[model samples]
Target chain A: MYAKRIITTMFLVTALVITLPKGVFANGHDLESLKNTVEQLKTQLDKVQIQLKAQEEKTAKKKDIRDLKQKIEQSSIRPVEFEINDSIVHLAGYSSVTFADNDGAGDRFNQVQFSPIFHYQYKDLMMLESELEFDIGLDGSTTVALEYLTLDLFLSDYLTVIAGKFLSPVGQFRQNLHPGWINKLPSAPPGFGHDGATPISDVGLQLRGALPPLGNVRTNYSFYVANGPELEAITEDGEVELEGIIAEGFTRDADGTRVYGGRIGVLPIPELEIGISGVVGKTEVTVLDGAAFGDEPSRRYRVWGADFAWKYKGMGLRGEYVRSTIGEVTASVAPAGAHWRSWYLQGAYQFLPTKWEGVVRYTDFDSPHASEDQKQWAAGVNYLFSSNVIAKFAYEFNEGRVGKSSNDDTALLQMSFGF
Target chain B: MKNYIHIKTALHAGVLILAFFLATAGAQAEKHPNEEGDSAQGAKLWAQTCSRCHNMRNPKEFRDELWVAIVTHMRVRAGLTGQDTRNILAFLQQSNSVARKSSFTKSSTTSESKGIAGIGVSSQDVLARGKTVFEETCVACHGDDGKGVVPGVPDFIDGNGVLSQSNEVLFNHIVNGFESPGSTLAMPPKGGNEDLSNKDIKDVIEYLNATFGS
Candidate 1:
């Protein structure tokens, strides 16, 4: 009887479930509405997060721009340059060519030259200046050489340290003057240009700067130390001959000794500059084959020099004097004491209206051992197309102390351009 | 001693040259316009005027003394006044230095315009309105010599007074009249006459530039 009651109760409950109302458990609309509400909440949260990310990114980008601007401003305070990676570089250039006629040597194309200048700078403290020149060689081939490759460390306005190959400070022409565009004439003073009396380049260290001005007058100085030149002694036809070979560029020291040199310049007025320079050093050379087969040791290549430059109105005047004393060679039987002297004077007048400049120069050189005295006079005119281009015509009259005045006269024409 | 007594003799000649230069240039040091010039203005003028005819030159092309003389020499041909000459010198000096320029372009341009401010006046247009009105009306106190006649008057040739002001400022000064507390004299409206029109003021500005700032 109990089992039968249990079975009846189960059947009654099952029937009650099947008979429930439609609204009691809610329709599909309510379930769909709840799902839409949840999806809407998720979309709103995503929008808010995206907006926040955009604001953060915008602030970061603005900071990056500000940093870039500050870096540019700081870099601009130094020498102007264009950046590549970690280095900054600048470009400059010079060039020249010439046609020459000589009484003894006949007419010929003298020389052609092109030079490019480069400057690389680091921060505001260090710098490198390089110049490469391509010149016509004796065999009519182009020869390349480094004019100067200097490294500079800026110490202050009053001091800068320079090293590597540098122009000699003993003569202003070798150091401060002689660019094709800057020089008014087609040629420089005799015995003062390349391969002349003074060595043009030195591998050395130098201190150079302009001193404090006195009134409106300006003053500058350069002090240097370098490997000195070489002096040679030879025996020919029972006579002792002495010679000085001035080689320039990066090279090993000939005598394994250093030279001390300095230049002091003063401008009493803005239009004039006066200077005194000197050098003291050791020089030694080995005689190839002679009565004495050993090296001829000469410790003294003492030099003294003076120069001046003045310009008034459109006229410019410049002059220089250099003297050298070579010590006696120790390996030769005869005492080979040699003294060398050179001097030149040049004047130029520029016609402002036509951009034309007329120049005249007189030069004299005395070489020891050869006992030769040479005198030269030159007259030239320059037609400048612009500041960077010039055409020059010049005539030179040369006379040795022993030869006729007309024996070695020459004429020259040249055009120069720079970018 | 060296055998070339000529070098010693030439040194004597060098001494003579030094003496002569000292005598000539001792008190004869030239006063350049660079000392008082506004370099910013000069650079702008150089870019605007000089670049019209040719490419620009590097300041390292000449020494300061040579640059001064060159600028002064060209002034006569170019018709630039003392003020413009000085400004050019200042620009060159700052440009030539390896270090940063001591005097930078002003951080804020007090009188500069934002965009294409000045009218595009061609050479012919400027020449048409050249110094006729200036000669007839402005030459009395301004002087026929081009310098200012009065002590406090505007020196058009030297970039003084109205010449120093911008085009808009100068125009307003002329149109509305000007009287400064520091100055005793007063500039009448429309340049003290009934003949000057608004176009006349433009002509005078062109005349000033052509005569003194070219």
Candidate 2:
């Protein structure tokens, strides 16, 4: 039994030795494979972490883009809407300051005038225009005056109906050339001022427009009926004599008379214009020595004028003549006739490439009173900063009745601006 | 006398009624169509009419809307025809905007030293187009004889006048604006016609050379 046990054990031992050798070899190989697998897992984990980081960076970039787009949308300017039918208001005007030295009156800053023109328009149908004048009086006080006001209605392509106080159609000087910036000289012509031969203004309705072109000759006409002028009488040397004619636009027709007047301008060429004007009415003496008067007889009143303007390149030439006559009055305190007449010729030449202009004018004024009759020559130099802004220097030589203010020579320096 | 008073009153009433009727009729009539203005004709009329009364105002002095009102006011004051008003307004409106950049391309035959050459276009066609443009645009200030009509307009017929310059210089002057040495006004770009193309300017230059060049 001992011998059999030993053989069995030896056989079992042999089997165990072969199987343990094979198993040991398999275990070592498996451990080497396990280590390789762990290394592969580590490499895979690193790759996953890199991919996740890439995705996170992409998301962050998208967020920045969104924020930038939001910022852009927040800041911008939009357009304003405008319609055609809306009412439009425009302001325009002229202003002037003058320094004057007269033979009798000393030199001073004698005039400061601001004329503001306001326009309110409702399409092309109608427009309301007004000019307000502000002046510094000689007494250092401010005076406001309405230069003119008109409601102009466009009746047709070539016609307009105007209602209100308007610049008189009697002459071109009062209507067109009176603006300080437009007048080449620093002062108005000798008798084209207040209470001059030319009527200043009228309150009435006017029809003014251009006529159809007649060949190459164009024409414009203005017709009006207005409250006429009033007369003044003075007590001098125990006799009543007509003093002056107040032709400024009167709000009331004290004489209950109407004046009919019209002006026709013909332009044979673009550069030349010839105009003729006339007025006929009746006027009564409403004031006696600056006081109100009653029961004065109405007298026949008439005014006539002629004017011409020619422009060539930088040179301009213009002339005007006016006459006013009052018929004799038999039933009034002032029974005598009176008349005023005046004429002026002016020429201007501008030196181009330079803002300089030279002007000369000759004027003759004849009035009822000998002391008021005058003849004058005016010469001026102008510097234009722009087309609308001008500086003028003028000298006037006057000849009249001796020792009268009308005979005083004067020098004027003026700066005028139109906007 | 009483009969005279009655007649006068009737006349006044008649005048008032006539004015009212005219106003109402004008107001009720059809509004003017939004017609395009003729900038070319407008330029000519503006040069001729504005100087008749006052010095020429700069187009840049006011905005577009303000020009409308201002021109309307001038229409009444100057007794301008409706066509005249429209034309002037168009010129002013076109002149007030920012100038456009020139689209002129250098021609193959054109050299820096030489003046300019007709690029693929016949000289005859170029000159014809140029003449039309000049008459329509420049004739107001520059007369048909090429002598200046206005005070400071440069004479193209003079020996040493504007046409004596190189074509390149003339092109630049027209594309941009130019003011004469002694002029009170400056020529607006493209002669105030913003619609003028680079080719139109080129043709005009050629026309000027053939017709008025020294």
Candidate 3:
């Protein structure tokens, strides 16, 4: 009790001292006031304590004393639970509703999704995180999708490394973060959506860090390898097989590709951020020899792309241009041809700092081999009720076509919440 | 002689280190505000410094209006007199702005440091709401001040150690009533009053933010 009183008095004195005039301490006027307040308050406290003690002695009951002792014991004992100091672990979930339309027949899909993220942190060095997503967009089924699970190692004050399933370091948006359903312009960059063939998440390892080198800014870089997925090529007989083997000890080097990519970014000012990135790699494919001969060897595929992003205050501007090459297709099969280019220009403006945000963007993709181009536009708004909870609504219009004659259009709305 | 001198030097360093730690510990101790500091004491302070020009209503009435008025009033008050009536307004605007202004000496600490997390919440509002909840339901002994005026009336603010709990714990206390003997005060559901939403209890807990949690 004496210790507690002394500490409280000291804090009160310091606070009083700060509130005093510039030379009040030197003039002794401040100390005088503090002394007066302390004396008066202490005298009053003593009287109250005496009165309380007298009352307690007069009406002391054995049951009451026993109860008081028990209460203190319960309150003083800490609960046994996993805790990182005072910070507690919590389960966070994010999801959004999207309505999409494509200019064509009724091939457009509209749906809602829930992506739950579990994150655990220990001070500044380590964090364990995993995400699970439920999508009703494709086939309208709830499939258990492993988003990413990783143990992030903060290697230095400015750098970090991760060895686990994580995003492929392909572009600024694709690697470190994803555009929110509402924060993105009407349409995402051409090759980023669900139907796009580019990879969003990869099972691999990555080393990324920032350097406050020359210039009036901090720059960053990332290197990563993507664990490719299994894909098949159709044969004359409509059969699918592994794509790289041809005969005894014969192969095409078309096995699953390892994705390699890096990014460079600069924080010119506290509120302004800019970054650019690119990735290249060959992905495996199962090819068909013919219906009579069955499926034969695989084919090595290559994909490469670049992107740039900028954010200032509540406004953001982002764009990415990518080209992928799928080398050889089949024996006499027409070549998959030139670079398949995809790009988009997007911008967002938040109403109040980061609480409510608005976005609009346009995207288009032209396949080197395909006859048609896919294009889209999106506009949306997001409302952040708190730091952890948010509501978003967006409308997207999509179009896919070769000439002006045959094209597809789509629209959507989304709301997501996560910490 | 050289070895002895080295040992002496090491001893001197250790003593200096120990003294530094002691001083810091003492400083920290002096800074911790007591949870059980009398509300009447706060009320007295409020009356003397605050009541002079402003109206004294139930804290609920002053909730929204008081903040804009207080923040603007405090600057002029600071310029003119003592402490600018700075009485742990943690309960008023949950964000500790005054504390930040005191600690952040550097000019470049962006507005990002002043998060909206603790904005617009005050302890008095929480206490007033907590008291109302306790009263509408706990009429028998735990009287208005949350100090249980009668025998067995668990003083929510003091002796019962309720005020020492985190907002969440206090929330559970008021939500899930005490069923055991030492906790005989039996906090009915929402302190017996079913009308108060869980949000009400959260506000009360936010009021107690300075009490239980750092």
Candidate 4:
């Protein structure tokens, strides 16, 4: 049934490609040609399978192994295969969920989300990928968002350029997915705000390339503009600092803000990867103008972080730290604190060798009083259905301090498909 | 106590030297030799000897250390004992190292080698024999399309000078399994069957050459 579904999907996609606008189709003719080739191969395979099935029935119990061999030869008299280059654009995705129980609170399911993605490539180069997410249940925030749209230009075997909105490449977990439903000892890393701002996506450009000496070194960097928090300058007290400022209405709200960041990573060995990433930019915030809404102010924010990851023989360990500071220069707005820091540590193991991966992560933030400012512990497992899709389930335990001290526990289940 | 101290110091020094040698060997071992290994023989050995358990391992998977381990393991698996295994190991390590080092050099030397069997297998009778050998041994994994089913199975379509490998290199892998860690499966000795002679494997290599390209 699954094979039938896959075949039907391929046929529909092939037909869709044929009817696409010529301009769009022409741009990706290489992809179209590869798709056609795969389709043709599938057709030939189906025919061969049908013949093989018929022969199997004919041979039945009285069939001699030698006679079966001769039957195979007779079947082989016809072309079992056609032209050969094996290439195609694959589409896939995956999702995860978790349930948890804190110290004394009632056990509950925490977060659940789905990330559906599409990937295109041939020969492992000239690739494009995009991820979309829709979250509900457990945490139950019903909305859809674009996760990342990356166009990778592999310049050479070792050099590549990625452009578009993507995970800021900040901390390890910011780019890495959740292991299961549990948070490790220290889950939240620095720079990520109380609302867990680490998975920040922005429209920007990046260049990722490797250094010489092949396996010794590699680096990734990016520059982008994205939606960010507002920053306004406040006096010693909580008053806005707008002494000698000319308010220009030239900035359009839709124009958004500018975000610039870069990440440089290195892999000393094939198993160990480490990197430092930083982002600095301005965000727009609105103020009340004597009971009326004021213009959006450009708030300056900076986030810097470092991460280390070791993956060898199915044992994976990763840790990251980030520090974020926001200073608002807008007049009349109160100045917030200097900086808020967060950090986390995580570890995972593949119990079923390379088939199933289990993860544990822990995160803590300074302001544990806010709804989103609690320490999180989560654990989960991922079952790889194939190289591309996976089924995941996890549990999270969140303890809130300083404020109301409500415990948020969650159970999440998700299925993600990707290319 | 005095003797123990001396032994400990010597052991420390020995450890240090071995560590340095292994590290340096790992770091600097990428200088590849000229294309000298028999890829055809390697393929046959892969089908005959290696395929008994696992699929054919593509040589391009490893850098150096892993390749060394894998090829050495295969030597033992092929029942080459010790000395035979070592010889075969030398051939594989030399060939794989050359492929890697050339890819990274100031200029790539991969294309410099001549196409395999530029002279041999040109005769019709020789081509016919080579074809038969291939049908009997190589046709399964390599497939009729010449695009093998498993990943890492190098397509014969555009492989440069793959068939043109030196007979010695071919014989080494054919007689001994590929020992690279990157190889998921070793090419068994003498294409695993042990029935064919070194010359038989050579004929198939020639057939691969004649069938794929000019």
Write one digit per residue (lDDT tens) for candidate 3, span A1-419. 67866786677667766886777556577668768877897777667767977998899599988999999987754444321142223354556665555444343436566777665644334556667777774666677777677765543433455667775555544543352433343335666654343456566656554553355454656655555533434443454423321111111223433545556655554223455555554444334443323233334445555665554334566676655455555642322323456777777765532356677888787754244466767777766554234455666665664544225444454554443
The best candidate in terms of DockQ: 2
DockQ of 4: 0.02
TM-score of the B chain in each candidate versus the native B chain? 0.41, 0.82, 0.34, 0.41
- Measured by lDDT, the strongest candidate is 2
Q: Model 3, B56-114: lDDT tens per residue?
A: 22232233223323422232221111111223132232221112121212222432132
On residues A13-85, what C-alpha lDDT tens digit does candidate 4 reach at each position? 6776687666664557767786786678777767777787798778755457778888897885534322122
Per-prediction CA RMSD (Å): 17.3, 12.0, 26.6, 26.7
What TM-score does model 4 score on chain A? 0.60
lDDT of 4 at A248: 18
Error of 2 at A384 (Å): 0.9
Question: Which candidate order results from sorting by lDDT in descending order?
Answer: 2, 1, 4, 3
Q: Candidate 4: where is the Cα deviation over 4 Å?
A: A1-87, A97-112, A122-126, A137-142, A178-194, A197-199, A218-257, A286-294, A330-332, A350-360, A367-372, A376-399, A402-419, B1-214
Lowest-scoring 10 consecutive residues by lDDT in candidate 4 chain A?
A242-251
The regions of model 1 sitting more than 4 angstroms off are A1-87, A233-236, A247-250, A286-294, A332-334, A369-372, A401-407, B1-90, B93-214
Candidate 2 at A249: error in angstroms? 0.5
**Candidate 2, B31-125: lDDT as tens digits:** 33123478888887787777766777878778777887888888877767666777888888888765665334244234332334453355677
> Which of 2 and 3 is ahead in DockQ?
2
DockQ per candidate, 2 decimals: 0.03, 0.43, 0.01, 0.02
Q: Native-contact fraction for each model?
A: 0.01, 0.43, 0.00, 0.00
Error of 3 at A337 (Å): 4.9
Recovered share of real interface contacts in candidate 2: 0.43
